[model samples]
Target: MTEVRKGRTAKRAASRAVKRRALAIAADGALILYFLFALFPVVWMVILSLKPANELFSTYFSFTPTLDSYRTVLGAGEDEGVPFVRFFVNSLVVSLGAVGLSLVIGLPAAYAAARWRFRGSENLMFTLLSFRFAPELTVIIPLFVLYQQLGLFDTYVGMIWVLQLVTLPLIVWIMRSYFADLSPELEQAALLDGYTRKQAFFRVALPLVKPGIAAVSLLAFIFAWNNFVFPLILTSSEAQTVTVGALSFLGGDRPKYNLTAAAALVSVIPPLLLALTIQRYLVRGLSFGAVKS
Candidate 1:
């Protein structure tokens, strides 16, 4: 009886081990497939950007890579037709402006929502979310009319204000959650030690959650930087963003595929660089409130 029991136990353990190994292998395969799906478009973009104009639609998959497209897009060519640098500067300005405005508005709102048990706080937060989720087109026409009437049409300030809608709710919601997860005890202790509420927040709470703040700022910056529609209809040449500028490659006569790809590559660089630089903060910020002491 003992010998039979031992044999059965060994068989069950072996079966369980095999099952675990199979599950792990399946998971790894799925991840690889997902990674490929996500990366293929980026690879294709790089290939198209590098290919010379003549080879753009060639049947052969192979082509000699050249810097002509990049040079043209970067305004390194003799003609300097494309105002890539100007568009880049405009995007940077708008992105920074949006981030500054959102943080200014969102931080206090988030702090109040987290710390105060005010009447209808939940409703207010939900209302903010509703605005956030609403389609941009729905508001665009009204905004356009209003801006035009108010003499804000085709202005940088108008575009920045419009982008605030994109960045504000995200900042408020994320910061509020982070603040809520943080213990009030820390603030209270600081207060007891003679620090004012504002001082306590700035000195104690803010410093500790610097990672979350950095993450939120980075996210806000990226959203504003990449926004296409607002800049598309809101402003013309004077305040055009990289997204709109990139579209210039597609004219009425013909599509400049190589130039478009090059423009796209140029548009992608700043945000990608920012993301890479602040990736650590992003991870830390996202993981905030995920664990408990």
Candidate 2:
């Protein structure tokens, strides 16, 4: 009887192990399918960018690949080919400027909102956040008129200012939470150590939330970079960004799909590189202060 019971127990353990293995396989297969689905468009765009104009319409994959499309998109010289490089520069300036301005202003505002109970604080935060939810189209017409009046249209400063609508609220809200999650005791200790309020923030609180800042800054930069409607209407050429400039290929008598694809791939490089460099901080930033100790 004892031997029979032992054999039965062994069989049950093996059955459970087999079931676990099947579940794990299913989960991995599902994840793989999702990744393929998500990456299909990017992969197809890369293939399109490699094809020459002559073979762009070819249904078969036997055609030779060429770099002519990229050359056309990037231009032979700074002033020779398309102005895509200029547009790329404009994007960098405006996006970086917007994110920089938001950090400078929003960091203090977030810290204040987190640590203090000023009157109308909630209302003020809500007002800032409301900008995010409001559709850009609702105000773009008036904003365009204002930009024109102020001579801000097609200017770098104007683009950065308008993009505050995109970057500011995100930094404030997310960083506010990070600040709130921090213990007041730390700052109190800083004060006891003879640090002024400003010094306490810069020396004590700021370093603690560096991860959140990196994550939020990356997000703000992406938002500013990808903004299309503001640049499309507010700027013509001088301040135009890659989002609007890339579409130029679709104009004229004939569409240049290869050039368009190449432009897109080139534009993606900066943000991709930035994300890759700071990806280590992203997970920690997002998850920090999420749970109580």
Candidate 3:
């Protein structure tokens, strides 16, 4: 009887090990396929950007690598009137401003929603989410007219405000969930120790959710930076962002594929750099609700 029990336990353990190995193999295969799908276009774009203009359309497909395309896009040598620098600066300003504004407004609103049970709070949150999901084009005409009347058309302020609609609701929802997952006892203890509500929030609560804040800020910045339609309709040369400026590659006769590819690669650098910098915080924030304490 003792030998039979030992034999049964050994068989079960071997079966479990086999199942685990199978699962790992499946997961690895999925990850590799996903990585290829995600990275192929970016790899192709970089390859195209490195090719010379004449080679871009040549019959034999010249494989010669050159820096001329990058120089043109960066205004390094021959390309003088491209306005790359202005567009790049404008993108930074608008993206940062939009993210800052969203945090200022959304963080407080999220805190309220998470900590307090106000009337119609759920309805308000849903309304905000609805607005976030709505198509940007639907509101563009109305906003264009309004901005014209208010003299905000073709201005950085107007562009930033319009982008807030894209980012604010996402910030509120993400931060609110993070705040909810935190222990209320910490804030209560701070209050008992004579910390004002605002003080407790700024000192205790905010620090605890720094990961969430960073993630939301990164998301908001990306949204505003990549925004094309709002800037396309509302801005001209003065406030044009990298996205709108990239369209300059299109002319009456033919599209400058080499220049556009170079411009696209340049445009991708800032966001790529930012994502790499904040990748750790992003991972933590995304995993906020994955496990329960």
Higher-ranked by lDDT: 2 or 3: 2
**Candidate 1 lDDT, tens digit per residue, 1-293?**
99999999999999999999999999999999999999988788888888887888883458999889988887652254568778888999989898898988898788888899767878888899777799899999989889889988777888888998999998888888888888999999999999999998889888877788888898888888888888888887888899888878777566777887788888877888887988888788878854211
Best to worst by TM-score, what's the order? Answer: 2, 1, 3
For residues 253-292, what per-residue lDDT tens digits would candidate 2 score against the true structure?
A: 7788888889999999888899999999987898885521
* Model 1: worst 10 consecutive residues (lDDT sum): 75-84
Off by over 4 Å in 3: 1-38, 59-62, 76-81, 290-293
Residue 28 in model 1: lDDT: 100
Best by TM-score: 2
lDDT of 2 at 75: 74
Judged by lDDT, which candidate is best?
2
Deviation from native of the Cα of residue 235 in model 2, angstroms:
1.1
Tell how far residue 168 is off in model 3, in angstroms: 0.7
Specify the poorest-scoring 10-residue window by lDDT in model 3.
Answer: 75-84
**lDDT of the candidates, in the order given:** 0.84, 0.90, 0.84
